[model samples]
Target: MSLNYPAEGRNYIMDAAIHGGQQIGTWYVALYEGDYTPQEDDTAANIGARATEITAYTELTRPELVESAATGGASDNTGNLAQFTLSAPKTVRGFAVVSSAGKGTNTGKLLAYQRLATPRAYAAGDVVKVPVSLILSNPA
Candidate 1:
């Protein structure tokens, strides 16, 4: 299924597929982010947002089918390394693996992967390393 999300200055679309299976559950969700055309200053400008959706209860396939359509990256280290500062230490349950870029002068091009946090303690300026690059369903 497809859905549209409203944003202040951007457009967003989300797609999801629920696999119809047995006891357990599986779903694949993809989000699209983009900006409307034209800018108030008569210049070419755009904005984008990420999209996420909940899977329906009637899905009957593997979420991979849907994820395949969405943006995805392979599992590899040294792909995209990012640094973020946490205002306060919090338990990172999950994260949306968006696009990733590295900052090292000699860093190689790497895919970005978002995953749960490790050790559970994150101080300010703690860096997060995502290994795979998520599908560019959304363009910012």
Candidate 2:
């Protein structure tokens, strides 16, 4: 099974109507080891897995990152699911989309996270691939 939209993120986005400084910047997909867990007090700084994050697969640099489709952004089901191929062995349990390319509390602000229903354990010589789609839309 794949990841579902998180309640933490749902609350955050819902509260944005009353909040003033809540803004999502560039989105980058970050893969974590099977041991990583999503935390409520997560900041951008320490978002990477403990020495287990795939470096090249950590910060996916893309032009049309992701934004709120409900607010005149891109349409749904259109290039929203990001596809990634593992070049090396990776025991991935979950992934996230962040705001920056750098790390640390002030830099690596995580926007969303999802844990795979089944872990993806890829070997060095294996062709591993997964699609992580960001669903940014209205509840209506």
Candidate 3:
């Protein structure tokens, strides 16, 4: 099962096994700052929307599997156990599973944005481990 998501000013396809789409291999992931409404201009280089991104994400460059395909999702979302140790105050509303690592000046494809079940508000020295998952099915 494949779904088309907006990425790099075009539609990027994903095999959403949950939505009857075929499953694929590894994909990159990133944590976007809360209130970051995804836009066409978003790239691997910028976590836009005046939203402050948390760079403490340990697996910023890891290619992980789609943890479990949801039965009615629009795309295949690979879930990962992300742990964050914040050195300053922060609030994270959601995350993004991208097609490539936005390291250096190269921006990759933006797969989808998964909002936290509950927004997390953290203070200095706070440690939070999030089970961030992806939903590529049921396009909005």
Highest lDDT model number: 2
What clash count goes with each model?
16, 5, 10
Report the lDDT tens digits of candidate 2 across residue range 1-140: 32344454555556665666576655666666757666665544555644245544333442234433543432322445444455567787776666665422236355666777668787655543435555555567
| TM-score (all chains, Cα) for each model | 0.27, 0.60, 0.55
Q: How many angstroms is residue 5 displaced in model 2 relative to the true structure, after the best TM-score fit?
A: 7.8
Q: Highest TM-score among the candidates is held by which one?
A: 2
Query: Which TM-score value belongs to model 1?
Result: 0.27
lDDT of 3 by residue, 19-138 (tens): 555443556545556665556556545643334456654344433434555566423433445455666677877665655554322355556555565677878777655454444433
Question: In terms of lDDT, which candidate is stronger, 1 or 2?
Answer: 2
Clashing pairs in 2: 44-104, 44-108, 44-109, 45-104, 45-105
Candidate 1 wrong stretches, greater than 4 Å: 1-77, 98-119, 133-140
Lowest-lDDT window of 10 residues in candidate 3?
1-10
Per-residue lDDT of 35-57 in model 1, one digit per residue for the tens? 22222221101111222111111
Over all chains combined, what TM-score does candidate 2 have? 0.60
Whole-model alpha-carbon lDDT for candidate 2? 0.54
